[model samples]
Target: MIQWIIPLAFICAGIIAGLIGEKVIFKKLKTFVTEKEVPGSDIIFQALHRMTFVWFVLAGFFWAILGSPVRPDIANAFQKILTIIFLYSVTLVLARLTSGFVNLLVRRTEGVPTSLLSNLAKIAVLILGTLILLQTVGVQITPIVTTLGIGGLAVGLALQDTLANLFSGFYLVISQQVRTGDYVKLDDGNQGYITDINWRNTTIREISNNVIIVPNSKLASAIFTNYHLPAKEITLTLNVGVSYDSDLELVERVTVEVAKEVMQEIAPELIANEPYMRFHTFNDFSIDYTLYMRVSEFFDQRIGKHLLVKKLHKRYHQEGIQIPFPIRDINLHGN
Candidate 1:
């Protein structure tokens, strides 16, 4: 009974310490982090939450094991196991911390994929931690590394497609040709905004709210147009035909006025490059030309066109400008 008191006391102490650390210390730290608005406070708290209590409990158990009346060999073995567990937990926390920070950094920079780089950072930390853990347990690393090098070749050969996608994802990120938030139209006619480029695939979200998952290798090699690159501004051309007898100068002035009004409403920033038109073709019944207007982005063209057509049609009516319909006259001679 007397011998058990020390071990029992240690166990009780561990529980108490764990409760205090988790309930009191964690709450205070979280409050501080929130109040300070630290750059990575959310990440730090997320990685460390619930871990404090476990660590304190583990520490208590380790001391209790040392004070217990157990065989020397058995005690040493238990201590070793506890050390491994503690080290592994620490490794997990470190991995999370590194991964979160990497993602935050990538988000701050333009044209970099957050998921891909952050995942890679986490993987690297985990691999390093694993190697350290193995060495701590008296396992020789040289032979293991040599084996992995030889086996890696075989694995790489077997996973050719997987490797291709992985490398292609890296290329996409580094090239910066295609980036998240860019509106792209693929060769296959699939148009969407890029959401993310992960290890295996790139995610695109269409205007219709449908998602497209294209493999990294395919996306990298595929012919695509990135409307956001070079510039987000694009010219929207509307082909219009008016009655042949209509006054050309009046038509141009009225059409341009309507276009400018619509553009100002839809995208005011593009007003510097005012809307214009040029007569291009003469038909039997009407004169055809293109009215060119500027829009902010690819998606804005829909609303811009809608507004422009409504305003142009109303203004044309008020100006007595007639939009003639296709008509053909036939002459028949009886022989």
Candidate 2:
């Protein structure tokens, strides 16, 4: 009964210490962590909460061993086991904390690749921590490092395409030539808004509700037009044709007026710019001209064009202007 009571008392003490950690220490720590709102700190605190009980148990274990009549060899072995557990737990916590913090930083940052970097950071921390832990447990690391070094060359050769994509992705992000939310069209006609750049491929979302997955290497090498760069403001041209008999001055005046109104109503941002028209050529049926206009961006042009055409058609009919279609006349002298 006495033997059982001694172990029970240690266990009970551990439980009480765990309760204190939760009620007192954790409460204070929680307040501090929440106030700071630091990226990845919450993850660290969560792991710490679970470890609190284990920590108390370790302390109780140490005290129990010191006070008991256990043999020297058994006690030393138990102590080693406890120390190893503590070290490994610390390693795991630090690794996760490091990775989580990097991820948080990436989300807040602009123009940086998040998922790839986050994963690389995690793998690096784990590898380094594993090496240290193995050394602590009396395992030599030199042989392992040498083995990896030899195998890496072979792995690189086997994964040439994958490595090409990975490096290209790195280059793309570093160069900042192409970026998220930019409307782009490739030379081969695959055009879309760049959505995200991942490890193996870049995700492009087209205006037609389709997605195009182009490999990073291919995207980097491809000649693509980024409408967002240089400037988002672009010039839009619309061709106009009225009957050859229509007044040229009146045509310009009415066309400009319609364009100005459309620009104002649909794209107020472009209203300040003056619209211009040039009579380029006299076609067989009508005089053809081009109307030059300004729009905010790629999508705004659609609205601008729609409004301008609709308004111009109605305005032209009201003014009795004729937009003649093609007409053909043939004279036969076969008699």
Candidate 3:
């Protein structure tokens, strides 16, 4: 009972001293570190504070027990337990530091996804820590290694599609084919701007404001168009029909002028040079013509075309040019 009392007193004193030191000393240290703008200094200070507390407790225990006529076996067991605890604390600190370092490195690089890199770093650290813990416990790793290999194989076979998508997602990021914020159109008729590219799927926001999740496997397999890359310019065409009696040259000129004015009115930055109207096809009831123009962005292409058509309609009315509606000729013979 006397021996236990000394050890308990030492532990209590160490705890009180640690609490006072952390509150008084380390709090000031934190302010200095923050003022210096040193990266990951807060984590370093936290780890140091914990280690100092641990050291104080260990020192107190050793001082209290060293003079006692303790059993050699009991002393060795206690030492081993203490060593294991210390190693585990060190491992935790190392893992945290490594994670912070990897995150910093990831931020410095361009086009690398931080989420994926951070996850990988964390997993690597956890695996290393697990191995260390197993070794510390005197457990043979041969059986564990064999079991993991077999289990991994089973999992691979069972989750082939999921794995494919995961790998495909990585490839997509590395290949730089489609990145976040790019407008894309898939073969399945899904068109949207990419919001996030994750390990399993890419999230897109459609023009209608609905979110679409596309699996990486499907994105890899399908033919898709990225409007941002290669070029930002998109060509827009407007098809119009007029009465055959309308003068072809006059109609073409009027349509081109209308397109130019519409582009200037709605999207002056999108307009590329001037528009051209071609008398394309002679339809059953009207002369079909096409107006071609270029816009700065794919999103504006549709709206600009619509505005051009509206302007053309108004202009044609002012010019007294007739836009013919569809006319079907039906003949019936009775015998």
Candidate 4:
């Protein structure tokens, strides 16, 4: 009983210290960092949050183990266990820090995807930590390394498709072709916004609120149009025809004015380039031409076309511009 007293006292002291540190010191530090708006403070706080209490408690246990008058072998085993636990906790912290930094870097660049890169960073840290842990525990690592090397080859051969997708995902990210958040239409007619690129597949969220899971290999090889690339603002073409009796100059002017109105509503910043039309055909009843307008993005084209058509129809009616219906002459021959 006397021998246990010191250990118990140490444990109690540790618990009290952990409570005070967490509730007082950590709370003040968190408040200070938040108020200051320090860069990387969030990441540091996240890595350390709730972990400081565990550290203090672990310290108490370590001291208790050291001071206890227990059997030599038992004390040694306890020490080894504590050491392993502490090392693993350190490893976890490192992994979080690495992942946090990776995500921060990607966000700043605004080009690459975050999930896959952050996951890879965390995995790398964890793997290195595991190797260090095994070495610290006096485990033989040479044989394990050799076995993994051989087994990896076998696994690679077995998982060809999986590896292909994984590599393809990397290529897509590094090449900056198919990025997250870009609106893309695949050659197969599936169109959506790229939500994420993961280890095996790319996730696309369609406007219909449905998700499309495209395998990385297929997406990499497919011919897809990225409306987000070359710029988000895109050119929208609306073809209209006027009656042959209508004024051609007035037609172009009115069409352009209507296009400018729609463009102003949809993308006012892009109003520098005035809308224009080209008369392309002399049809049987009406002259056909295409109206070229600019909109902010691919999806905006829909609303843009809708507004242009409605407003043009109204304005044309007000101006007495006749949009003639298609008239085909029927020859009645007794055959």
Ten consecutive residues with minimal summed lDDT in candidate 2?
A: 106-115
Evaluate residue 262 in candidate 3 and report its C-alpha lDDT on the 0 to 100 scale: 74
Q: In order, what lDDT does every prediction score? A: 0.90, 0.82, 0.77, 0.90
Task: Candidate 3: give its CA RMSD in angstroms.
Answer: 6.7
TM-score comparison, 2 vs 3, better candidate: 2
The collision pairs in model 4 are none
Expressed as tens digits, the lDDT of each residue in 1-335 for candidate 4 is 99989899888888889898999999999999899999898998888777788888889998999899989899999989988888998999999999998888877776545478788889999989988999999998889999999999999999999999989989999898878878999999999999998889899999998999999999999999999997878999998889999999999898888899998899999999788999999998899999998888899989999898899999999999999997678999997
lDDT for each residue of candidate 3 in 1-335, tens digit (9 for 90 to 100):
77677777876787777776677767887898899999879757754657667766766666556544588788777766766777776777777677666656644553334354455566678778877877887888889989999999999999998899889888887787887667899988999988767768889899999999889889988899999787667678878889988988889888888888877875688666677878878898899988888777778887887788678888889988999987688999999
lDDT per residue (tens digit) for residues 1-335 in model 1: 78878988888898899899989989898999799898899998888877898898888888889889999999889988988888888888999999988877777887444488888888899889989998998889999999999999999999999999999999998898888888999999999999998999999999999999999999999999999888889999899899988999999999999998998898898899999999999987789999999999999989988887898889999999999997788999999
lDDT of 1: 0.90
Ranking by TM-score: 4, 1, 2, 3
- Summed over model 1, clashes come to 0
| Residue 49 Cα positional deviation in candidate 4, in Å, after optimal superposition | 3.2
Candidate 1 worst ten-residue window by lDDT:
105-114
Error of 2 at 91 (Å): 7.0
3 versus 4: better lDDT goes to: 4
